[model samples]
Target chain A: MNARNCLEVLRKIKDVAFATVDEVGKPQVRIIDVMLVEGERLYFCTSRGKDFYQQLERDGNVAVTALTPEFQMVRLNGRARRLANQKEWIDRIFEENPSMNDVYPGESRYVLEPFVIDCGNVEFFDLGVTPISRESFPVGGGEVSEKGFVISDACIGCGKCLRGCPQQCIEEGTPFRIMQEHCLHCGRCFEECPVQAILRR
Target chain B: MNARNCLEVLRKIKDVAFATVDEVGKPQVRIIDVMLVEGERLYFCTSRGKDFYQQLERDGNVAVTALTPEFQMVRLNGRARRLANQKEWIDRIFEENPSMNDVYPGESRYVLEPFVIDCGNVEFFDLGVTPISRESFPVGGGEVSEKGFVISDACIGCGKCLRGCPQQCIEEGTPFRIMQEHCLHCGRCFEECPVQAILRR
Candidate 1:
């Protein structure tokens, strides 16, 4: 659907996985709560004393994703900005997430800091359906990433790639076409092509 | 526990999240199957034609993680080597994951290639317990990564870190001690130190 809807889905799956690069540039990931979602931004929080918090402060870049029981997945690659009004944000977060009160308790909650991810590309992928399905949109003026494969002019139109496609998302043409929404980006066709035509964009 | 045990947890989780750095250096992640785990290596597969395959081929580094519903987590960061015995490995993977037959059928399964993470750091974290708990081990001669913060000799042992620690993992000592196993690796203690003696490794 749209960016907001995708984020809403992630919010619904509150316990989502967040990945960030450590100081040494190694990717680190953990399960984090989606504290709140409003407008185009998704919010979450971590304690100031943890490496996760330091990682966020040092490298604002973060990737978040969650797959629902129905095989619906929402992936967001974006910037995590610490909100300015910490108290107000934390208060609102606690109000929305009452269970948090049990962990932080009253004044101790201040140790946690809130962050928002509003600018990035959001992708929705559903594996439950036949041929799969996917869509992407940008949030807060961010650019949608051009991922996956596309057939180039080098196509011999031999239909080799089409036959190998697990999703059967390739359409025959002078150069052939990959149905973006239904494609798995599995690269099965890229290798099957007699002519090196399928290119990743 | 041990590295093998951590990988076993991931294998049990099966649908784990894998993170990789794309060509642009941004983090990209998805739910991938943890096809098999024997001894010190964890196995998985992706079609050779996808960007994921290309990224792995180009970088060889990957991060794998999954959180169980009970709040236990397994995190692995390591080198992913494209196994030499591709056909044999793929066959083993398919045999271990019979449901795959429904998707690929027969010969089409050949498109998927097997990769193994035999060298890496494995971490086991259990959040379900009070004060939390964590441990790290190396896989296949890989070095165990030194992560988290360490209280240096400069520590005045003011106990500020201990008091502020959410997990109460910091113990008072000449330099104050952060019990690595119970430490959240959250930087609260690092920020609480007035003398700024805490150092992240």
Candidate 2:
């Protein structure tokens, strides 16, 4: 599936494991409800009085992962931009999640603010599919860079890197290419290359 | 539930969203399988050639959260200590997870290493239960410090701190007390305390 479809999986599985770095640089994670998924952007809400709110305000960088009942995993790494003029979104959130009213009754719900992740790197892994297919793509709008190692023209077709690759994703050809989709990006091939042919992307 | 039971939930869920800080201090999260659970300790394995293994080696500090099908979330924060002797456990891991053989055949399995979280802070939250029950406990050993704010005898029955508490967890008493479980720990009450009675733990 494409990046937008991957994000759609996040919307289907509303409960996501959201992670953020604390002031001390330790990773903190908790299950957060996905308030809304409009186009390629995903939105979430937290009270201004909560630590989660403070962490987002401080760092903005966050990672979210969700596992579907079918065993598919979608992980997104992005910066959480606080949505301005949240008056309309807050009402939308309350209307979308009525149970939230039980937690924050009446005007107290006004303390909640909405944050949106506009764009970032996303990895979608479908463990339920045969061969466990997976791919990484960019969400929203950005240049998506190939993450795994790439083979340069310096390769003499020695086949050493292929032997060293744990995933065996290297192909036999002139200037052997590493399969970006299957590569683990372990850097083993880069270390094993005699001519230093492998370049990390 | 207690610490042991919280860990049990993690084992039952098996796949957890594990969070680790990258070199740049941004939080990174992915789904990882719990290899084993002995007592309060949880063990996981990853190939030494992978970036995940390198990050753990660089900073053992990690956070793991798993949500059960019933909506129970178990979050554990702690340092991951690499096991010294892998010969014994590696064999056991392969024996327990036969599918791993398909991924890493023969001696290639030796690339994998096991890490254990022996002691940590664990929070058990069950949204399936009424009132959204939640509790925090220490796993393995050491003191279980109160997570949020604590009001000492210095409170002097002052109710000013109560007004500043966002969660309204503070109650009037001989010495005003903040409900540790419900406290947001935003330090609003601590800052507003007239007698400096609120202490963060």
> In candidate 2, what are the lDDT values of residues B23-65, reduced to their tens digit?
8898889888888888889988887656677779997988999
Off by over 4 Å in 2: A143-145, A153-168, A186-200, B141-145, B150-172, B182-201
Error of 2 at A105 (Å): 2.8
Q: Can you list the residue pairs that collide in candidate 2? A: none
Model 1 ranges with Cα > 4 A deviation: A152-157, B152-158, B172-175
lDDT tens per residue, model 1, B149-195: 89999998788888877677788779899999987766777777899
Task: Judge candidate 1 at residue B48 and give its lDDT.
Answer: 75
Lowest summed lDDT across 10 adjacent residues in model 2 chain A is found at A125-134
**Total colliding residue pairs, candidate 1:** 8
Q: Assess the local accuracy of residue B148 in candidate 1 as a C-alpha lDDT between 0 and 100.
A: 83
For every candidate, what is the interface RMSD in angstroms?
A: 1.9, 3.4
Model 2 vs. true fold: TM? 0.86
Q: What's model 2's overall lDDT?
A: 0.80
